[model samples]
Structure formats: structure tokens, C-alpha cells
Target: MQEIFDENVFKKGIGRQINLPFLKAVSTAFKNIRVRFGRSFITIGGIFFSLTFLMSTFTNNVIAQSLLASGTDEVKFLLQPMAQEVQARQVWLISLSLLVCIIGIMNAMLTSVTERYREIGTWKCLGALDRFIVELFLLESTFQGLIGSIGGAILGFLFPLFVNIGKYGTQVIEVLPWLEILKYGAITIVIGLVLSIAGAIYPAYRATQMVPADAMRQEM
Candidate 1:
């Protein structure tokens, strides 16, 4: 019995472990939930449609309006209606993309704060300042935002090509401008980073405000 109790007997077969910090933990949680729900990806697809339609529409609309205002024949007869339709679709698409981004950010931040309540409490009890904890949460949020932004960019770029390739046999897509992509990508990343941190701040602050004893009592 004593020989059977030996800890070393199983040591060779045991594996080492790695530790992940709070930020990484939050990111992983969001990643898992996003995958499991499958809605986030769908939202991303919606965003793609919205973004594409809006950009094309706006581009054509502005050109047509300018040409009309200038009293020029440069505006082709066929292009006006096509441009208007594209513009209308684009408006809807832009709106949808904005909605998706808002919902996604909220979901990620809300889930993160809910799951990490105990860990946050522990940090507070261990003499961590509220601001430090807030910064920690912010860092996690920023990382999440960056990841989402990158993913959105990749998807956004590829989506237009995917759609065009499917339609009209890919004879050099007349739609999908690079400038708009750049503008949107930058805006998306900044907004996402801000939204993520904003979402976490309240929950993190609440956790930090509790007394050490109270904080410690939280369940993992």
C-alpha cells in the first residue's frame, strides 16, 4: 500500500502545465462563445453584405450627383438607376454592419465580465489597485477588439471578391474600392477597441470597489 502511494510512480507519464493570464482567458472565452453560438460569424457575413452594398452605392451616387449638378453628359444614362439601387442597398448594408458590430462588442464584453468576476475579485483582494485592474481589463478588451477588427477586415476584403466571382464570371470587379476598405478598417478597429474597454470598465470597477473580504468571497 505504501509503495502504491508513491507520487513518483506516475511522474514520468504526467505532463507539464501552462498558465494563461486574465486577458488571454477573456479572449479565449469570447472565441469559444463566438464559435459555439455561430451567430457572430453570421453577423460578420451580414456586415460584409452591408458594407459592400453601401460603398458601391455611395460611390456611384456621389459621382452621379456631381455630374448632374455640373450639367455634364459624362453621367451615362444606364448608370443612374444602377447607382441609385446600389446606393439604397448600400445604405441598408451599412446600417446592418453597424448593428452587428455593436451587438458583437456587447456580447464579448458582457460574457467576459460575467465569467471573470471571481478572478477580478481576487485581484482586488490581493492589494491590486482599481485602476490597475481597469487597465488589465482594458488590455483584454483592446486585444479582443484588434482580433475582431482583423477578422472583419479579412472577411470584408475577401467577401467582395467572393460575391463578384460568383456573379458575371469575374471580369475585373467594378465594385469594392480599397480606400473605403482602409477607412472602414481603421474606424472599425478604433471603435471596437473603445467599445470593448468601455464595456469592461463598469463591471471591472464594480468588482474593484468591493472590500477585500467581500471580493475574496466571490466564487470562481
Candidate 2:
């Protein structure tokens, strides 16, 4: 019975040890985010605006559809020019905006790695693995993306309502399909998360390649 109890204790210890690296990396990432709140906020803001812009295109398309379905000649005529412009340029605009977002995220993460050179060196010297460093940065960006995406989606959904209300009052707002708007919001969130991860890949890889000695020599 004593031997069995010892084995169980050992297994539990092993399980905790196995989870220690992930927990440490996550904790360190959160600590760094708190310490570098300004940079993180900038990154999140960029993501929020980019996603909001992208989702605005989707919102515009939906609004155009609603206008077309209204069966009012005056409404159709009023929206026709705008609808054509959106159809012609929406894809290009979304693509350009998404590209900008990715670039912004990558730049932010790279700057973060550069600014934290000394801390990273310390972690390396303290026996942190390369993958742990990568994981830490990725996790931080993922959290930022999540917050930014939700904020952007909310703003995007409201944008059309405001515009329509301003143009034709609240009665025009009823034409919108709430369910479709929700679906577009969900897509935007997924896109934001994916962009965050994709943007971090190069910076994370570059960070892993840094020599601890060289990083430590740099001024913070």
C-alpha cells in the first residue's frame, strides 16, 4: 500500500512538472503585457481599427442588399451609386486593410522582442527553451487579438445602423438581418485571431534565433 501511494504521488508530481513550462510561459507573457501596456494597447488598437474597417465592408454589402430588397424606387436610386462603388471596391479594400493589420501586428511584435532583449536573454540564461519564448509571444498576441476583434465587431455592427439612421431615420434600420450580421461578426473574430497568430510567426522565429549573449549585450 505504501509503494502504491508513492507511485501515485510520483505520477502527480510528473504531471505538474509536465505542465510547468506552459504555465510559466503564459505567466511571463501576461507579466510582460502588463509591464508593456502602452505597446500592447497600440497593437490592439491597430488590430481593432483594421478589423473594424474590414467588417465595415461586409456591413456595407449587407446594407446594400437590404436597400435593394426594400422595393422603393427612391431608396434604390439613392443607394444605387453607393452600391456600385462598394461592389467595385469592397474586395480590394478588405484585402488592403487586412494586409495592413498583419503588418502592424508583425511590427508591434518585432518591436516587443527588440525592446525585451535583455529580459529574453535573462530567460534564456535561466534555462528557458526556445519554444517557450515563442509560445509566450504568441500567447500575448492571441490575447490582444481576442480583445480587439470583439471590440471591432461591436463597432462594425453599429456603424451601419448609425449611418442608415442618419440618412433615413430608425425605420430604415429594420431592413437589416440581425442573424447575418452576427455571422459576419463571428467571421471577423476568427480572422482577427488568425491574423494575430500569422503575424507573430516571423517575429517568434526571429526571437528564437537570438543569441543570449548578444541579446544581453544590447541596451534596453
Candidate 3:
């Protein structure tokens, strides 16, 4: 009679043998971004434009004030009450755009999970664990978030600056609120990172639940 294999001992041995490297997951994430640029672009664009909207809303008044004149003292006094109203509206707009951004990211990543069914199975068949798969997707989102956030931040500030310079000349840059701008930029970047990662979590969990046999049988 054949000797029985101890399942628990076998599992312990396999666990000890597997070593997943962080660099490997990071490299795979970069490769996937390049190989799937079109999808990656869509995901990044959602974050990019959303952050752009946010940054513009954030600094619109500050830049406008520096470039435009309030006229007589009476005009400044008249607009004071209205500023709060305008800011409240902007807050609503920002909140809406960010919600859409989060949804867009989740949808795009879900698509990726479906598309990579065979790839996921191949990795699983080769002894890849669920944690490795999750890590790959998270890294992809992190990089996308970083690029989109930085690009959006630059464009958001530069576009406004260009428009103001055209309309008001160089004076706009001279009196610029650099400190406030930097603070908003940093805050926006953090938001982008958190949103990107948040959007990927569900899809990553879905991917981890895939059965290797079924996933491998998937058409695409």
C-alpha cells in the first residue's frame, strides 16, 4: 500500500518554501501598466481630471483675487457675504467629482480583474499566492495615483497661471499665494493616493477569490 501523505505537513512545507518578493510584484505592476496602457490610461485619466477639478476649485478664488480688482471699498464689502456662498457651492462640486472618480476607478479595476482571469490562473497554477496577486494590483494603483496626482496638480496650477498671465500680465505670479498653493497640492496628492488604493481593494479581493481551474478556463 502507498504511504499516506499528511496534508497539514505538506501545507506547512509549501508555505516555508514560498518566498514572494516585493520587488517582483512592483516590477509586474509596471509591466502590466505598459502592456495594458490603454486601460491604464483610462484609470489614470479618471484620477487626473478629478484631481484637476479639485485643485482648480481649491485655488480659484485666491488666484482670482490676486489678478482681479474689487474696485471701490463698497464693492469689496458687497462681495464679502457672497464669498461664503460661492465656497459652499465649490465644496459640493468637489465632493461630487471625487465620488465619480472613486466609482470610475472601481469600475476600471473590475474590468481588469475580468480581463486577467487566465493570467491570474496561470500565476496560481505556478504556486503564486493570493497576497501576491493583491500586491500587484495595489502597486499598479499606487503608481497610477502618483502619476495622475502629480500631473493633475501641475496642469491645474499651470493652466490657471497661464490664463491669468494672459489676462493680467505677470503681476499674478508676483503676488501668488505660494504657501497656500503648496498646502493644497500636498493635500490633493494625498487624496488621490487614498482614492486610488480604496478603489482597488474590492476588485483585488474579487481576484483573490478566483478558483484556479475556472479562471484558467476563462476565455479572456
Candidate 4:
């Protein structure tokens, strides 16, 4: 009724390198994402929304500063630097958004662990190590985060730009800090990746602790 790992093979493998390749873990992560499309979508969307808000505010602030630095009387009439209190409020909002996104991701991953009880058990039975399980979870979250953050960063940057263009005319494009925008975009992407990986850490650790027999017996 049940097939467990071969005791002899398990015993022999104790002295050898049996950890799965990183590429294999990555492949499995991709498959998991494809299989759990809806959950993956929500997880990615949360990351996207958070990063979009972050990038948009930063872009807007940068735009205001650039317009001011242009030394045009028009800039004074058209835009004003954000007040200190306003900037502080925006910072609070951004921090809250990111925190919510991380919590959402953590919940999604934990649900995944519960749903894939049998699958995880099978992997362990076939010699998959705890580290492999952890790697898979991290890879999954990172992939989702990478896609979401990149999309968010581009959308966030462009949306404010378009709005500014309407307000300041196409000439406003010439005044933007292109180099600075690129730098911030790069930093935002890194933050997204770190955020997703951090969210998955606890879930990944949970996956590693599953007992093969108990997990296989679980009903998803």
C-alpha cells in the first residue's frame, strides 16, 4: 500500500553527495509556479503593487526636484517640493505597503506547503534533502518577485512620467534625471528580491521539517 525509500540505498547514500542540483531545484520551482498559477499570480501581484507604489512616489519626488533644478520660473508655478511632513507620510505608506506584501507572500507559501504534502513526501522518499526543499521554495518566491518587481518598476516609472508629461509638456522629459532613475530602479529590484526571499524563509523551513511518512499520509 505504500512505497518507502529503499533502506539499503538510503544507508549507502548517507556517505555521498545526494543533494539535487540547483538547476533541478530551479526547474521544480518553475513547475510549481505553473501548477499553482492562481496563487503565484496573487503573490506576484502583491510584490508588483508594493514596488509600483514605491517607485511611483520616488519618481514623482525626483521629477519635482528636477523641475526645480531647471531654474525656470515656470517650475515654481508648476510644482513645489513635497513638504517634510508629506515626505514622512509617504515613507510610512511605502513601508506599510511592503510589509503587507511580505505577509501576503508568507501566507501563500504556507498554503502551498499544506497543499503539496504528498508531493513533498515523495521528494523526501526519493532522496531529496531538506536543503533542496528550502531551495525550491526560495527559488519560487524569487522568480515571482523578479518578474513582479521588474514589471512594477517599469510601470511605476512610466505612469508618473506620462502624468508629468501631460502637466509639464513633452519638454519635461529632457529635464528628468535619467541616470538617477536607472540607479533607483536597480535598487528597487534588489529590494523586491530580498523581500520575497525573506517572506519564504519560514515557509521553506516548514517544508524541510515534514516527515516523509506523515506527509505522505496527509490528505491535501
Best by TM-score: 4
* Candidate 1 lDDT, 1-220, residue by residue in tens: 7676676556532333123466654665466445545544443343344334444434444334543444224334534567667667766766776666556655655565566667666665554556665665566555555666566555655655555446323332343345755675566556555655565576556555667576457675
RMSD (Cα, Å) for all candidates, in order, is 11.8, 6.4, 3.3, 4.6
Per-model TM-score versus the true fold: 0.56, 0.85, 0.86, 0.90
Model 2, which residues run further than 4 Å from truth?
A: 1-19
Model 4 RMSD in Å is: 4.6
lDDT, candidate 2, residue 124?
Answer: 76
Worst ten-residue run, lDDT, model 4?
1-10
- The digit string of per-residue lDDT tens for model 4 on 1-220 reads 1235577677778756368999999998999999899999999999999999899988988887788778378766656554456678999999999999899889999999999989999999887889999999999999999999999899989999999888888766988989999988998899899999999999999999999999888887
**1 versus 2: better lDDT goes to:** 2
Go through the candidates in order and give the clash count of each: 4, 0, 0, 0
Error of 2 at 26 (Å): 2.5
lDDT of the structure predicted as candidate 4: 0.89
The TM-score of predicted model 4 comes to 0.90
User: Residue 188 in model 4: shift from native, Å?
Assistant: 0.9
Give a tens-digit lDDT track for model 3, residues 71-125: 3355356546767788889898899999999999899889999999999888887
Task: Sort every candidate by TM-score, greatest first.
Answer: 4, 3, 2, 1
**Alpha carbon RMSD to native, model 3:** 3.3
List lDDT for all candidates, in order. Answer: 0.53, 0.85, 0.85, 0.89
Report how far residue 58 has shifted in candidate 2, in Å: 1.1
